[model samples]
Target chain A: MSLDKATVAHVAKLARIRVEESDLEPMAAELNNIMTWIEQLNEVDTDGVQPMTSVVESVLRQRSDDITDGGYADKVTQNAPASEASYFVVPKVVE
Target chain B: MNDFASRIIQGATGDWEMVIGLEVHAQVISNAKLFSGAATAFGAEPNSQVSLVDAAMPGMLPVINEKCVEQAVRTGLGLKARINTFSVFDRKNYFYPDLPQGYQISQYLQPVVGEGIITIDLPDGESREIGITRLHLEQDAGKSLHDQDPNSTYIDLNRSGVALMEIVSEPDMRSPEEAGAYLRKLRTILRYLGTCDGNMEEGSMRADVNVSVRRPGEEFGTRCEIKNVNSIRFVQQAIVYEAQRQVDILEEGGSIDQETRLFDANTGVTRSMRSKEEAHDYRYFPDPDLLPLTFTQEWVDSLMDTLPELPDAKKQRFIDDLGLPAYDAGVLVAEKETADFYEQVAEGRDAKIAANWVMGEFFSALNASSGDITQPPVSAGNLGGLIDLITDGTISGRIAKQVFEAMVESGKDAGTIVEEKGLKQVSDTGAIEAQVDEILAANGDKVEEYRGGKDKLFGFFVGQVMKATQGKANPKVVNEILRKKLDG
Candidate 1:
């Protein structure tokens, strides 16, 4: 897929990111090149191949479903930029 | 046609049918989070149960909790679904304050469990099947407590990364009552399997209700999803409101928009949260940090063997083997503890009588006193003993109610309470004869009036005799003796 300045700005807005007007063209052009490079794999001709989802051949490792850790609320929230009443506080989010 | 399926709205032009489906998120019954070893207990202080992995610290990888997978499989089997031997996890990218990570790890495109069937028992002695779309395992986001401050919101990540079984149902329900029944039946099965607590008020179980309205036999209308309805009653209300809203829009020649809505518990209305076009595009990709989950057929079978007799099977047994009426069987099997209590009381006794006492007196007593079955003030054995008293004519049915109240008050067995209080039925003819003679002598005017054809005085005579004996008189014996004396 190709990208344009307006589409790039729209995507950024949907992601809740503010994009500068001067940077949209460069970002869109860069994104288009990446997309085109990735699209080159369409030329390969294998029809019956299964998609490889992971590199590891092992089964998913599991742990017993027991409460082996926690009770460190102080440590967990210590790095929050703003915290109060044992909770991370942020500017009001409406819904 | 079923009556519940017939409940419809007479719109500006004609009748409309509501199509409803539910996506229920039931928290898995585990002590730890899904991918971390942190405690998953509810109502803890904010962030108290967070581990580094749940907090999304740098360089921390996820390890699946094996018991959670077992729970999901058992749930699938209980719902009569197909369990996949191979499944993968995909990350759904989004941004929210409660979500520590920018993306949520969910199973998309290929969920672990496939199609299943949930048979909902309609009130008209008919059944309807709501198809199960799919079930997937996903981690929960934390809570955003907005009421904590006016200018800021507080976040509690204690629930973050907790394992949940997201069960999606097909759009098969036609009315609000059907949706309610569907939720109740689903919850009952999950509770019986010990996979979920099914406590909606505690937020352990929640539903996302999708509602759409259309003219009968027309194409499906645009649907909206109501998010996080915590109670079954609220789910019912939300469906009704959202469906009516859609119908109103359609009747005005306005098209419905697919969107997300919120059910207002206070106003009993639904308000738009966002339109579908403005919704976040969740770019999903398989997480490279974890491997694909694979389990053998043997493992799934073993879990199947562990499932207790589910609600439908138990209900059938109660009806076929125990001869309980369909409605009574349904009521008794709504909860496992209640079903077990009914079985214990019904063992070798008159099953119909057992059903009556459990569904009638016992249930009302529990409701009146705000009691539960786990530690019932009146034990099942004692309840059975009370029923035995009435069955064997040791006490009349009227007298047994008083004895039952005494048992609840004193926690005494039926026989103990009868003997201690001298409340046994006075079946001895000689004893009843004496009380009958005294009542005949004292109520001379009434006896004359009765002989003068005041036929209703017979009940008065019986009442007096019963009152003299403290309601312990065998009703049949009292009627016979009083009839012989009063008629004379």
Candidate 2:
């Protein structure tokens, strides 16, 4: 699948990234190239083969429902650019 | 089928029927977050319950919580839904202040549970089966506090990564009442399973309502979703408002735009959400951090064995085994705590009597005190003891009510309250005969009237006898003595 500049711009917007308008065409071309390279795998006849979710054949590990972590609110928000009362602060999102 | 009057809006041009579906997000009742070992308790300090994994720290991985998966499967079993043996979690990519992970771990194509059905009882005493499209496990986002600051929002990651079961329903509900009943029934089942608390007010359970208007028997209309209706009543209200809004638009010859809307509780109206929220391209893909979840049918069967008798079965038992009226059984079994309390009271006692006492005075007292059946004013054994007093002729029903009121005022048992207040029924034949004799002697004219075809005055005589004994007289004994003296 080839990527268009508009599609690249939309993806960037969805990711909350501020992609410059001038760079959109180059980014789209790069993404298209990557998609083309990945599309090469589609040429192989792998019909009836089960899709694999992981490289390793292991089930997801599950932990019992127990509160073994937390209570370190200070360390959790310590690296935040803006925080107040252990809450990370961001611009208001009303919607 | 009989009582369902289509919840239709009579537009100026034509009639419009509402079609509603609800996606309820019930927080799993586990001790920890979905993937992190953080406390999942509500109302904690802003971020006191946040773990590094919950806050999305770099390189922190998520491990599945076993109890949450079990809960989802148990809920699926309760709903009589197909529990997919293999399911995969997907990343629902989005950006929001409350979502620290940039994407939510959810199930999209392969949900934990497949299609199921829940039976909803309407106010008209008719029941309908609403189809459950799917139920899936997902991580909840954090709490966002926008009004805490003038220009910024505060984010608490305590709720982030918390396990949630999003139970989606088919567009089977045709009325707002049906939607309300659907939520109530679903909540009851969840509470019964102990999978979720189903407390909508506490944010343990919430609903996203889908509403559309269509011509009777016509194709479905464009549906809009009203997000985060936290209460069942609000869900009903939102459906009504949203459906009417759609009908109004259609009636005006305008097409409806499918979008996300918000319900304003104060105004009882629904308005479109921001335009940006409408174009949600989640770009969902299987989460590579976690492998596919697979379990054997033996495991599912074991979980089913652990399932408690759900609301429907309990209600049926109350009806079939206990001979309770359907209404009373429905009322009692609506909440798991109430049903359990009723069962405790009814144990080894007359089921109908116990049911009456529970549904009548017990529930009344509970509501008056704004208390729930979980922590009722009277214990189950104590309530059973109270009912036993009436059954064993120890106290008349009238006096038992007095004893119950006293028990409520003072935290004493029925027997002790009966002893202190002298509220025991006077079943002694000698004492009742004397009271009857005296009443007859004083009210000679009424006694004659009673003997001379005025049988209604018999109640007056009984009342006098009871009053003379301070309402402690056994009603049957009083009636027998009065009948022997006056009628004979």
Candidate 3:
């Protein structure tokens, strides 16, 4: 239920978040408090309960295999910060 | 065991064995994306196929596609795998530029298909069964073109949110050849099911190979994953290089660092991509947007009924019902179209002869002209007619070859070719006896040697008789007359 500074830093790195080193202890403490509050539910004996994926009592809905939305490239990339020739451009990433 | 014995690598200290497993990602053949209504066609204008849900815009929800689910179920049945009526989708968290959603919805705890087995036919006429671990559905990320720009990468979201089946195999394969056979058989099955195209070159299907080396009969070694091998040849090559690389490390007393690697086709080598320190920690959780997928056993059975006769069953029937040799059966049933053609040719004819013609001259002609079996130059019915000529004593097997060549050249039926060319077999005993007497008169000294116990000379007399008759004499009648004339 506790979050250490290193764990917080690792989580931040995984999320690609720029967390200041100076705020690590405070953030870890705050996250620890939240986790401790959430851990209180572990005390309840709910072995037979099923895990819930949705709040609504409905099965997953399926769509037919039809192309109903496309062909508007301009609208598709309208929100891109940088685009060229109908492509979203970002920093080069090679693995 | 003998075939696999050659696959073992001899290190400086001992013989090393390779343990291989494959993870194949096959794109579902569907018109639209997995969770969106956008088109899934390839080679479209960049971003033209992207929908709001695929782009992972805020508040956009995902809806499953019925066709993709049905395809996954059908594929499971084809593999003879167990279908889980209840399965859930989980979000695999990661950070990547191409993955705009920052998480890929995959099946983790409960996969759609459970364990199964696939029997792969080897080149040495032996087969081994490879185990299937699981098959689950996931979303494909958008393609990123890194070489497009100097300092930036161009991203096309057209492939985003496409449905892909991640088929994982057990670490049962001990050789690169086994790995190759396994991929080919799996591709054949996938194509038969019509679930996935299994076109590796077009990027519709690709495999991730895991290779490790260990001393024979020891615990499994640390393995490395080679990512996105696009072809079966490259997959085999990657396993060989990676297995040797691991062997060299172990022989030198250095342990392998379990991580992901990349196979370079040009170099035919695998290089480390990421180390264990930066390994992925995919925290998976059930997605709240979509509920668990549930279906009845009756629905699964209905899908099963829709599956075509897979390669294994067809191969077995060819051997059991048609009395074909295992090798011929394997070759005929490798492709669905070829198998269908064989069946058509073998319909009321000699199965073995039909197989020989289909696998021999028929296949050669098709290959020489680069023709597909689906649209062959010679139809199956015409080939059957050609076989009929030899079966009913219309023409000798030797003359039948000439007639077959003529049929191929002129697109004429076997009967027309036989009639026009006068290539009918002379099965009359009188005509064969006259040719045999002429040969006996000409090769008088050889005939004496044949009566003096040089029995091999009898073949020469038969050859001479066949030559005199222009290869039109029925071989059985020629043999009978030659035996009587020479022996008397």
On DockQ, the candidate that comes out on top is: 2
Candidate 1 lDDT: 0.90
**DockQ values, each candidate:** 0.74, 0.79, 0.76
Q: Rank the candidates by DockQ, best first.
A: 2, 3, 1
| Cα lDDT of model 2 by residue, B112-131, tens digit | 99999999988778999999
Best by TM-score: 2
Which 10 consecutive positions of candidate 3 chain B have the poorest summed lDDT?
A: B1-10
Better of 2 and 3 by TM-score: 2
- Global lDDT for candidate 3? 0.90
Model 3 segments more than 4 A misplaced: B1-7, B275-279
Residue A11 accuracy (lDDT) in model 1: 84
TM-score of chain A of 3: 0.92
